[model samples]
Target chain A: MVRAEGLTFYYERLDEEGNVESKKRAVDHVDLHIRPGKFIAILGHNGSGKSTLAKHINAILTPAEGTLWVDGMDTKEEEKLWDIRQDAGMVFQNPDNQIIGTVVEEDVGFGPENLGVPTDEIWKRVEESLDAVGMLKYRHHSPNKLSGGQKQRVAIAGVMAMHPRCIVLDEPTAMLDPNGRKSVIQTAQRLNREEGITIILITHYMEEVVEADHVFVMDEGRVVMEGSPRQVFSQVEELKKLRLDVPQATLLAFELQKRGVRLPDGILRNEELVDELCRLKSKM
Target chain B: MSIKVKNVNYTYAEGTAYEIHALKDINLEIPDGQFIGLIGHTGSGKSTLVQHLNGLVKATSGRIYFNERDIYGENFSMKELRSKVGLVFQYPEHQLFEVDVLSDVCFGPRNLGCSQAEAEKKAREALHMVGLGAEYEKRSPFELSGGQKRRVAIAGVLAMEPQVLILDEPTAGLDPKGRDEILDQIESLQKERGITVVLVSHSMEDVARYVDRIIVMDHGEVRFDGTPKEVFRHYKELEKMGLAAPQMTYLMQGLREKGADVDADATTIEEAADAVEHWLKSK
Candidate 1:
């Protein structure tokens, strides 16, 4: 659903008079592609340009050089800005910032209403989106009264009401507690699986990325590593070098292997690691 | 030698239609020079309880004693209590406002009536303690990275030379590396200076690895208080309150649940790895 070739974005330091003083390349010559209906995760540390790169997907930042296409439309095309945004809905990190309406249902319907969707269809999409995120019962509650996770789901529902083909969530769970984080991830997974909406999740949490079909690790404006979760996590040392951590189970499995335990590589889940240890114990 | 809370209850907007009991009859003893983790889900009254320690929020009922002195007693100096108990709110970088990093750090000490030289000296010491050297003294705090700015903010509180430091979610919004760096600096400060540290965090792994004691709050009450292992043992109970144990704890619990002959008390990755290895070898 998305493709980028040598995509370069430069953030300019503006002088007092609005002249560009200097330019820093936030995304540099990165080649990336995403298949429709697949869950893709982008992992990077702060100032590693992950957020900068995410902004490009929604045409928030036009490329200073090279190209990025969302669902066959070039983001650089000013005329297709609305279309590109409609194709790839964006959910930002802070739920408080994105949510504008006082009531939850009204907030969600705002997205569809903006798209000039029919009034009847807008209400229909609002209920379905809220239902999808398991927040339909809270439709009448004020956004301020909801928990962090619930607020974020309402934010997601707002985006989903736009009926986008893909959703790009930029660190959506960063501000949430563990339960909120779990619920948001489950909502994203369900959207990808049940609704067949493509998902691009940017996050700092290693555990959240384990289930993604594709993982991209970015550093210094570059995609340093790209692979399946198992393939990427297996190289524990490299990820650590990038100042990223593997999931606890993967790290534990790696440590066990280091201590002369004959465990298999690329253990991703808690059950997988425990089962391997159990099998080893039985053999012993 | 400590902060003591007895039967403390806090109600916001009492006697009004919006009256809400933010904190219940809570009692806590925060001993000196100890690292404590205060953990709870959002709106669980963790923040309310911490605010009471430094006298930021008065208790609706009950009393608080700091260093054997009742904080609400007549002749008690609120200024002295605030200076001795430094509370760093979440996103403390927003608290930075001075022209330079040094000036910002000096703001707290200067406010306490220290002369300019003494305030600068304290600022220098605090900055060094937070791992910022003299070279960064003149740099504007606004120009620093998120982690660096956060360190400067913490330095502002540390400059006051408090015996106790309380930080609310110091690692929030930071990347993994930044989070570790801030926590490591805080840990070393607590160790080297013998400053009492109360870390308010949502990350179970961080609390497990850093703090000596964990206080689990739920519904405005202290549900559990013990060492990390002891508190995390009630992971099932925590889950019901919208909280969870560290990932390693979950792994260990998962092993036990699946009938594996492994101890489920491991709270850290290294401990869990060693436990699993030992279990395998013994088998």
Candidate 2:
């Protein structure tokens, strides 16, 4: 659903006189392609340009050089801006910032209403979107009164109401508690699995990325690694060098391997690790 | 030096239609020079309880004693209490306002009526403690990275030389490496200074790795309080409260459930690895 070719973006630091003092490349010569209806994760440290790259998907920030296409439409095309945004709805880090309406239902309906969807269709979309995110029961509750996870689900519903082909969640779980994080991640997974919506999740948490169909590790404004979850997480040392981390289970499995226990690489989940250990025990 | 809370209850908008009991009859004792993890889900009253420790929010009905002195007693100095009990708020980078990093760190000590030289000395010391050296002194706080800006904000609080430091989700938005750097700096600073450190966090792995004691709050009450292993043993209960044990704990439990002989109480990665190796050797 998304493709980029040598995408380069830089922020110009202006001096006192409005002249460019220096240019800092936030995303440099990055080439990546995200297939339709797949769960994708982008991992990077702070200021590593992951967010800068994600902004290009929704046409929020245009590339200074090279090009990015969302669903085959070039993001730099002004006429395609709104359509590109409609194709890839963006959910930001802070739920409080994205949510604008006082009530949850009203908030979810705002997007469809903006698209000039009829009032009846808008209400219909709101119900379906909220139901998809499992927030329909809270339709009338004040957005401020909801928990962080609930508020984020409402935010996702707002984006889903736009009928985007893909959703770009930029660190959506950064501010959430453990349960909140789980709920949000599960919501994203369900949207990808059941709704066939492409999910591009940018996050610092490694656990959230383990289940993704593909993973991209970015550092210093470039894609340092790209592969399946298992393939990427197997290189624990490389990920660490990029200032990222593997999931705890994977780390534990790696440590066991170091200590002379025969364990497979990139153990993504707790059950997988347990099963592998048990299989080893059976051999013993 | 030490803090004691007795029968503390806090209600927001009391006597109004929106009255909500944020905290309920909370009781605890924090001895000096200890690392404590204060954990709870959002709106679980962990923040409310920490605010009470530093006298930022007064309990509706309770008493607090700091260093054997009743904080609510007549002639008690709230200002003195504040300086001694430093609070580093969430997204503290937003609290940075001074023109330069050094000036920002010095703001706290200077406000406490220290001479300029003394304040600069304290600021430099605090900056060094947070791993920011003189090379960062003249740089504007606004120009620093997210992690650096957060460190400067923490330095602002540390400059006060507080005996008790309370951090509220200090690593909320930071990346994995940045989170580790900040937490490690705090850990070392706590050990060197021997000051009581209360880290309020949502990451179970961090709390298990760093703090000596874990206090679990739920519904405005202390649900569980013990060492990491002790509290994480109640992971089922924690799950019900919108919390969880570290991933290693779950892995250990999963191993045991699958009929493998393993210590399920292991909370950290190192501990779990040791347990698994021991089991493997026995086989």
Candidate 3:
């Protein structure tokens, strides 16, 4: 679980004389609360501070103004840093930069080994983690031989090996193809549903966010909107004004509604839209 | 100028244990003023095949002809070939090293031995084409937004005035709005300049909506090459190769399976809407 109050972060540019020439508030007075065992999605444009806010959840960036707590442990406490990080894990966008181990099994074991897990237990955790991500068959192979999607799943397995209560993924599917994207999202959902691990997925993909239990839309360093996926996606114009988009089916339904077809909003999936149209035809 | 590939075969680290047949015997022709979309799952040799277009990677066997001249033949100017066939790698914003946007864009022209004035003029034109203006010329390329930085990188290649432009996942990390903005600019620029454009991407929706032709690669081979409708018609085959058609196409297919009389050829949302409206009217 994660909670924040008036969370504010500033990025400063120093002049040649070491004085702060200009300061930009990357995250401005954002308040948020995330419950345990729930899948949450954060959507935003490029400079909307979604990634900046994600850093706060994992203690990667401490609050510059207000307070943030991960698992009830204040990130500001110096001694609690390790405990906070142990409670929450972070995955980044680039697959190549995060992976260090050459072999797949060894890579997944690095996190637990760093946490001082015992030799025998590290292998056990690695096997379980890789199996959770459906990569157990690739245990002995080099990670370099895997595809981008497979490499990302291995990254998630590495994070899982640490046994963190929450995992924060920052645009994990941005570098992948559609199939790869589906594989990564399904894995995350399975982690949340079956394993009860908390998931905070930060991405720009509208379709991927449709399956989330809660959706938070951020813009210009502020939490502009927050609700269930249906509640948020129904306001198509508001999201469009914020330079974001709803799922394709949702957009199509909205467009059809504008043409006087009298369809309901928040149609997240293709099957839902098709069924709606078929019902309308039957009524006619 | 058109590009012709004849029985091209490319092997990486050939004759070694680690050798990879990155491209198998491929034959294709790309005409001038055409827009192409290259789609493949990762490690499917799409990147390997594009590198051959600009002479970055030589073929292990077979030949590539650019405008009827063999690229591997003697007296063929690789330098000229590079300028005339610009290829922008994925995440090209990392390659912007110059302090300011204008200088960064001008680097390609300057490297080609153009004078400062000429390079600056071309860079200005290129930036303008990508929807930037004079205000961005003096600003640091690093300070711009992600979409703007990508546009600046594209301008860097555009300053060379290439006859053919190849972009590998140009909109990879951008948000929807930024992706649409960049793709729209590229589309208009291709039309305005009449240059051959090859876009390598993973988004079936984007490629289906914009490209004139679609080329599908699978395991170092050109599996299919045709119009977007033709390629997407075999959506099942594509799914087997870890690929898929646009969401609209799938929706239409689902409708037909559900006993609705919907046309399955709709690749875009507008076309799907029209088909659905027609069906509703008939009912």
Candidate 4:
């Protein structure tokens, strides 16, 4: 439920006298439309403007040129800012920076409570959100004592308690270990599938994007590519040139194809690559 | 030239209600000039173990020896040990407090008693090694991009010219290209200087691609210690421990399970491709 048209944002660099010296365009003229309940992934390298684009979705930064609307509410309109943010919640990379409450249950409830949700209803929403992220058992425990994965789940629960229609995770798994990464991605997927919540995941991890409904590749502040996972991953060389990566299985399949092996492109999963190779072996 | 850990046991908040055993009876022997990958899930004691290597954290009970001399010995110089075993921590950019990139890199050498001129020379060399040229020397550390900032932080450690370098999740939060750049620099530096390098990371692909040895830690103990191929052979066990082998390992395993005449021990994409091609030709 997010849309953008010619969305452009620039960071102004001021000189010694406080005069604007130059402007660096963080987000170029980019267009995007995210349907409700769709799981979308945005991939790019450092300084590629993917994070800048994510900020626009939650009204954290308004577009310098053109327009952005979340749930049909224009982000530029002052009165609609709060509504826009409520509709699209944002989760950043660092859990420690986002998590402020001492206790897990209190952290999850803080979001809804700030939205003026009733005390009793806040607790109810807290329970549901924690349960959704599979952290209900830790509701009473101190968040500082939890592991990185558990703490991230608590952060997601906090966002979920706000009842946002869309959730934008900006590299939530960057600071996590392998298990932590898997758990957080699974939590996002479950919310997308069972709760019908729109998911906008921005990450450098290609494996995480394999299961996304739609994938958008950004570079130099522009949307260079946008398609289904298969369509985007099929261009291994292009992705590499853009300073991004494909899944390891996809890369292996691409290498084989380059060596004159008759294999299909864009093999996302290990099993798919194995099955394909086996089929080829049988033909041989 | 070597680091040896003997029955190291580290406990946090000892004798308190929150006492936690951070490290078990850990024993490890690191020889000279080896590229090592240290991996574990969150709170698995990888960080704690690395901190012990450079004498940052004292073990509750046990001994550590660097260059065959006990680090805990009264005659041993902890400052000297720290200089020789440089540690680039997680989020190392947070340690950058100097105004400019050059001065930031110079801090470590300066702290080690190098004169300003000597430190500047070493800092410039270190910056060049990390691929940051002289043009970036004058820029503010805060004004640089994330990757550049990370490189400057790394250069801060490299300027010390440590015989053993330990990096904890150095590439965390970086893009793929940035990750590759930093890792390649570290690998080359290790090779060129013939120095020991221990990389603590969460990415299986990275460890598989670079390290000569892989040490898997679980519950404050070393669960597996061997070469990448050897350690990754226990992929199923790794997964159970909240860790995993590289995706290539799984692909090879999947191929073998599907009755393809391919080896399942390949840990890298090139190796996996070679195995599949060999199998196809044989067929």
Ten contiguous residues minimizing lDDT sum, candidate 1 chain B: B274-283
All candidates: DockQ: 0.73, 0.89, 0.80, 0.87
* Residues A1-284 of candidate 1: C-alpha lDDT, one tens digit per residue: 99999999888989999999999888999999899999999998888898888899999998999999999999999999999988899998789899999999999999888889999999999999999999999999999988899999999999999989999999898778889999999999999999999999998889999899999999999999999999999999988778788988998889988999998889999989878877877788
TM-score for each predicted model, relative to the true structure: 0.98, 0.99, 0.99, 0.99
Error of 1 at A204 (Å): 1.0
Residue-level lDDT tens digits of model 4 in B1-283: 6999999999999999999998999999999999999999999999999999999999999999999999999899999999899999999998889989999999999999999999999999999999999999999999988989999998999899999999999999998888999999999999998979999999999999999999999999999999999999999899999999899988887777777768888999899889888999993
Error of 3 at A192 (Å): 0.3
Model 3 gets an lDDT of 0.93
Ranking by DockQ: 2, 4, 3, 1
Please write out the lDDT profile of model 2 over residues B85-191, one tens digit for every residue: 99999999998999999999999999999999999999999999999999999999999999999999999999999999999999998988899999999999889
Error of 1 at A252 (Å): 1.0
Best by DockQ: 2
- Weakest lDDT window of 10 consecutive positions for candidate 3 chain B: B274-283
Best candidate per lDDT, number?
2
lDDT of 3 by residue, B1-283 (tens): 6899999999889899999898999999999999999999999999999999999998999999999999999999999999999999999999999999999999999999999999999999999999999999999999999999999999999999999999999999899999999999989978988989999999999998899999999999999999999999999999999998999998999899999887889898888888888788884
- For model 1, the superposed segments whose C-alpha errors exceed 4 Å read none
What's every prediction's RMSD, in angstroms?
1.3, 0.9, 0.8, 1.0
**Model-by-model lDDT, in order?**
0.92, 0.94, 0.93, 0.93
Cα displacement (Å) at residue A95, model 3: 0.6
**Clash count in backbone of candidate 4:** 0
With a 3 Å backbone cut-off (N, CA, C), the pairs that clash in candidate 2 are none
